[model samples]
Target: MAKIDKSLYSKEEWLVIRNRRRLEKQLKKQKEQISYPVKRKSSKVAFVLGNGVSRAFVEPEVLSKLGVVYGCNALYRTFAPDYLIAVDVKMILEISKSGYQNTNTVWSNHNKAYSNIKNINYFQPSKGWSSGPTALWLAAEHGYDDIYILGFDYKGLDDHSKFNNLYADTKNYKKSNEGATFYGNWLRQTKTVIRDNKKINFTRVIAPDNYQPIELNNFENYNTIHVGDFQKIFDIS
Candidate 1:
């Protein structure tokens, strides 16, 4: 740990600094001691799992059997995908505390704040993107011929008036009664990924009543399929 000038900081600030430095050192040491397996590129198909309520019935394990699975924050509590992506600080801290990165593949933006947690891979170029779109970008980076986006409903569950998430009531998430989060950034990021990877077909699976944003329809490589139709196509039932 670097030497701290005690004279410059108050007691509470000094204590917080000391604790952060200690945690960073511990994480760095743990990273150096463990070895992780290199990911294999065996499949051309990829499934990016978003936390939208539309995909509540879809089983990640079932998708895992078919192709590579990429999931976002909080999903780790129930399912460990082929690759997990989390960019939020609170979510990353929670994941680190649980020691998930030690055994599973996790991807996040590179930050000096959490640089010592080197057990997981950091995103190149560090776009500082949201978890769902970042996961989509990661899937596109793998050169998958087809990417299916599940549970990416852009609106709230209750007719766009409330929160719409599979884990809304759980820790680190907004309550179901909370107002809907703005989807502008997510829409732009998702569109950028599709536009950049024109060769890759991007299929978004949604429920019958799920909101279909007008912006996405402009992309030639992007298309939306009903969740029931997607299930039938994949024999997921």
Candidate 2:
């Protein structure tokens, strides 16, 4: 008879304890996020983009008025908006003793290993998704109505960048474990969802580009809230 690797069980138990403490801490702190709930304002959703150049155009003051600004981890470092949603654990933070690969934005909630946001939900990794649009779509599924995508540039080598690529140490990719899309990629997929679900009254706010604005306008019931500039349209007065 072969002996079982009993050592594996101890590591598994440790993971459970670690994950449990993390969840408990999140539940305790993030309850304050009720202030940013979609119900509080109604069917208005702002798809706050991360640190892409397009974000530079958003005019932060304008975005805040519509509702809660759920910016990416970059926002945590700079904007520090009312709500912050970090999708990948590895990207936003790196657990290294030497601090070799650590990039920007370390969570201030350093005491507890799991502390990220208060009341805001941390994205659990979804397997078999290609682009960041998958995450945005998931966000829509979670009930963010009138979705507005601010900065999803996807700008990198060959003008293609993955959500987690910014922090990757090695260039290996497996479809099983990667985060979602941003900018133009996120916008297009969201629009497709709206079109596919013909009967749904989906309001998607996005940047005004040459090709998209015209094509989307032709669609019958799709109410597209194409803004000149989020900063200007919202009138950050």
Best by TM-score: 1
Candidate 1 on 123-235: residue-level lDDT in tens?
55577788999899888877878999998988786779999999998889999999999988998899999999999999999889988988789999999999889989888
Best by lDDT: 1
For every candidate, C-alpha RMSD to the true structure in Å:
12.2, 13.6
- TM-score list, all predictions: 0.82, 0.45
The alpha-carbon deviation from the true structure for residue 17 of candidate 1, after best TM-score superposition, in angstroms, is 50
Candidate 2 global lDDT: 0.45
Residue 123, candidate 1: C-alpha displacement in angstroms: 1.3
Off-target runs (Cα >4 Å) in candidate 1 are 1-38
Question: Given candidate 1, what's the lDDT at residue 21?
Answer: 91
Give per-residue CA lDDT, model 2, range 1-237, as digits (tens). Answer: 234455666988867866877897787665543222342454356454444443455566566667645455434434545444444444334322323214322222222344543332333322223234443444454455455555444433232433333323332222223443444544566567566655444444444541244555556645545455444556743
